[model samples]
Target: MFGLGAYRRWLRSDRVRLGRWGERRARAFLRRRGYRIIARNWRCPAGEVDLVAADPSGPIAFVEVKTRRDEHWAPGQQAVHERKQQHLARVAQWFARRYGLKDRSLRFDVIVVVVPETGRVEVRHYPSAFRPPC
Candidate 1:
């Protein structure tokens, strides 16, 4: 029993480490894709945005990154529940108004990072994934 508990704890720790590593990789991937990273791990009273970036197309992108070892429950995109979406949108608005970006075009994006068993990172960027509720 003790051995099993220890193994379980070890597994949990490994998962967290992998998730953090995947987030780092995802940030790098976005930067390489021509997105100018404006903020990382940004926090507001509304909520948190994992990353905020800008594209040449004039849209200030609010990005949420989900990292997992595999797609066990569903794709990482599914993790952004409606409540979460609402909070993100509110936070994005706060971010924009706070920085006088109200006139700028805005978009919500999601990036999913899957770390395979072989330790290869797979990144998927979903542009304009959700819109702010009216």
Candidate 2:
């Protein structure tokens, strides 16, 4: 029998693996669309931003990736609620300041990856997902 703590650890590790896989898919999707990947899993005092990319002749994109096994519960993008957006915004602000990108245009994006049992994966990208509340 597995102890509660061990089960929790296993679950956490599984989720981490899923997230990493999803981020890879997201990166490929962005690359195919002409976005230059700047960073992956970038972190700051505020929080973590999954992927940072420079769009071709466009604003820098701060991406948040959500991975799920299925969409029965809800679409992965829906998981990025208001509080999550705020967290991402804070992280983006910190990253921008650190990289001297304050003067450059920036936007938030969400990438949702759904991996189902059928061996097919779905990726949905939302550009300009939301604006940070002032």
Question: Which residue pairs does candidate 2 place in steric collision?
Answer: none
Global Cα lDDT for candidate 1: 0.86
Q: Top model by TM-score, which number?
A: 2
Model 2 is weakest, by summed lDDT over 10 consecutive residues, at 125-134
lDDT of 1 by residue, 67-100 (tens): 9778988999999888888889999989998999
Give candidate 1's TM-score.
0.86
- Estimated TM-score for each candidate: 0.86, 0.95
- lDDT of candidate 2 over 67-112, digit per residue (tens): 9999999898889888999999999999999999988999999999
What is the alpha-carbon lDDT for the whole of candidate 2? 0.94
CA lDDT of each candidate?
Answer: 0.86, 0.94
